[model samples]
Target: MCQLLGMNCNTPTDILFSFEGFHRRGGLTDHHADGWGIAFFEGRGCRLFLDDKPSADSPVAALVRAYPIQSENVIAHIRKATVGPVGLANTHPFIREMWGQYWIFAHNGDLKDYHPAPGQYFRPVGSTDSEAAFCAIMENLRQRWDAPPPLHELWEEVQSLTESIRAHGIFNFMLSNGEFLFAHCSTHLHYIVRKAPFTTAHLLDEDVTVDFANVTKPDDRVAVIATQPLTDNEHWTRIEPQQLILFKDGQPLYCS
Candidate 1:
């Protein structure tokens, strides 16, 4: 299986510190080294980077590690290659245009026999069940509404669709559209919110540390969600199994 990393902040923020630990799982700290990619959402536009190489060894990954691109919503993934070949098109987080926004998706689990009916509007560029699943979601949305639906309705629809997909196999994933960040936990997931009076954090996978007090102001608020905890010091809240969470403005919006 692959892994997921997501960030939702009240203000534009760079994910270099969290990404440093998360990227290592692509080849160094863990074995999900097929390929990797990330998308950073800034206003209505997004900066997406994909590499069909192990993130630990890819020069492009090195550049990203050094660059300080800032955004309010971000989604990233490191693949283990269960459904598609190790190539650029197969890498995630995959991006699509919908309702005048760039929708980003990243999956952390494998599905079995998940072929959806062919459609003219939504189709997969890569032969991965993950991409197929993304297309299916978009197609369903497009068929039901011409514009972005209400957040509550969208959450219900997404939860229902995710539940259907989980019946096939594990369906843990992260999704975002520059407005809201949605995360579903089929097995393992955790998150932490950093706000005023933030403290230092030590990366569990790398020999790096960051003191939030030195870099952030008194009003900055940020949320980091991942398949696993990235830091050792912060008390991350573990997501309950089979739960769907939507995050916006650094806070969680749960479906009722």
Candidate 2:
């Protein structure tokens, strides 16, 4: 299985603190070390980075840790390589264009013997079930509507499609389209929301601590989602099995 990390905020925010701990799982603190990647959404564009090396030691990962790239939505993944070879194309937080927006997706679990039909427009460049699933979702959306539907309606279709896919096996995943982030929990998935009166928090994998209040405005809100809790102090809400949640402006807008 892989590990997933996601961030959604009302204002553009850097993921340095959380990613510091999450990236450790790619080889140092945990064992999902086959490859890793991340995507940060800035307006309608996305900055994507991928590497076939362990994130804990990759120079690209080091750059990401030091850089303070701000984004409204972000998704990251550290892979353990159950279904595909250890390579760049197999690394996730995969990206594709849909409805004039970049849709980012990352999966954390395996789907046994799952093989979907070829997609009309979107297709996987990698030989992983996660990538196949992503293409299938995009194909479904492309076939369901002539254009992008409203957010709520779009979520409904996403949920239905996700449910169908989960029937094959474990399907925990995170998805985002710059505007909103959608997370589905098939197994382990947790999240924490930080807002007014933010407090200091320490990382579980490192000795780093940051008092968010010192760097953020009173109105800023941030929601962070991961395969497991990243901090040692703050409480993280564990998403229920089969649950799908939509987040915007650092708050959950819909859950089912």
TM-score of each: 0.97, 0.98
Model 2 clash pairs are: none
**lDDT tens per residue, model 2, 1-256:** 6899999999999999999999999998988779899999999889999998999999999999999999999999999999889898898989999878889999989898889989889989999999999999999998888788988999899999999999999999999999999999999999999999899999999999999989999999999999999999999999999999999999999999
The clash count for each model shown is 0, 0
Summarize candidate 1's per-residue lDDT along 1-256 as a digit string, tens digits: 6889999999999999999999999899899779999999999999999998999998888988999998999999999999888899899998999888899999988899899987667899999988988998888888888998888889989988888888888888988999889999989889999998889999999889999999897988899999999999899999887899999998797742
Q: Please list the C-alpha lDDT of all candidates, in the order they appear.
A: 0.90, 0.94
Best by lDDT: 2
Model 2 lDDT, residue 57, Cα: 94
Candidate 1 wrong stretches, greater than 4 Å: none
Candidate 1, clashing residue pairs? none
* Candidate 2: C-alpha lDDT: 0.94
Task: Name the 10 consecutive residues with the lowest summed lDDT in model 1.
Answer: 247-256
